[model samples]
Target: MTPTDPFPRVFIGFDPREDVAVNVLTDSMQRHASAPVQIAQIRLSQLRSVYTRPHNPLQSTEFSFSRFLVPWLCGYEGWALFIDADMLCLGDLAELWALRDDRYAVQVVKHQHDCESGTKFQGMPQTPYRRKNWSSVMLFNCGRCKALTPQVVNTASGLELHQFQWLEDGEIGELPPQWNVLVGVQDVPEDARILHYTLGGPWFDDCQTMPRSELWTQARQALNHPLALQASS
Candidate 1:
């Protein structure tokens, strides 16, 4: 079936205290938008392990939400687009929404970053998914994702919620770039629909080239609200 047949809904993971993320996600759901978007705050407990505790400082809080992606989407009715806060839905999502199929859990390919840090992330490998991990902006089949989350999250070394790189460590099917594209990192073929805030992000990861991003605009607007997170959170 084509994406136009029955558009897929968009779903993004939201950590609490991120009103800016919430605002942008809700705003992206405009009727003129390409498709529907849903936000799910991850809820889970932590399991202690070696790769999780001794080495990874952010371990306790990181992987807890990592494995929840598939489970969260599975709870939904059909196909969905999963992206981080660093993206904006510029074009109609109807095309992406239609990628869900029973055969495989679709996602974009992971390209290695040019920077030393990105390349360095490539060095430490343990999970089955790290072999060719793609960017976080994934368009996937919720049903497929559900079937695979257990295997992905329950690896021998377990999951590592790393902060610096493209891709989550999971065995997901490949979706076309039209579904999820990274602007700065990925070549961003002219026909590509979405723009991933790759190098610099909206909230201030690496602000070298991230200027006038749609997310930044939404972030500014969110801070104007009565209960908003400040710059120094």
Candidate 2:
């Protein structure tokens, strides 16, 4: 499908528990985006009608399964980007938006993530699965991803959706790892485009010491600065 909007559409997964994370992420994206972006929050509260799946124990966030509805939400046309609210955009989002390719159903940073068995933010179980963290950041070619209809997203198992079972191996395109750099878990580079606080971000008291967490702190400070607030007003 052809894009109707000139700007990129970004849908961020928002969990009420991490309100600050989402706000900081949005501010960071706007600060760094070269062009205006259509950003929307995929909060489960607003999607109860479309997403009627029973809660799974392993589900860590409100948008865990709701994120799959990105294609359906776009009316199965054009393209859109979905990202976790816990991320902090460090580079221009236009660069990531430009990487969108219609030839594939979706593009993602395919991380070989094997998180240790334990707990994460809010003491959620740190369950690991195949293609872990892949769904955290996705470039969805909506038209080609017709298989992710609302019905499918509501009923499919966690693995079926996260592992891209609906699409062939070739349909899953790869993005540069830097685009979804895993904080704490990976040796983050100085120029990481997107920082994924997969384990937990500095927002939590316990995660204040996580590597590279100072970046998030700086972003939060910049977001609330008097000058920044005055400029936005």
Q: After superposition, how far is residue 38 of candidate 1 from its true place, in Å?
A: 4.1
lDDT of 1 by residue, 147-231 (tens): 3344344442333422212233344556666444555556656665555554434544335355446544754475455867679
Stretches of model 2 off by over 4 angstroms after superposition: 1-5, 227-233
lDDT of each: 0.47, 0.90
In order of appearance, the predictions have TM-scores of: 0.58, 0.94
Tens-digit per-residue lDDT, 134-213, candidate 2: 99999999899999988999899899999999999999999999999998888998879999998888998878888888
The residue ranges of model 1 lying beyond 4 angstroms of the native Cα positions read: 1-7, 16-18, 29-39, 43-55, 58-68, 72-77, 109-114, 118-135, 146-172, 186-190, 205-208, 211-233
- Clash count, one per candidate: 6, 0
Candidate 2 lDDT score at position 23: 94
Model 1, residue 173: distance off in Å is 3.9
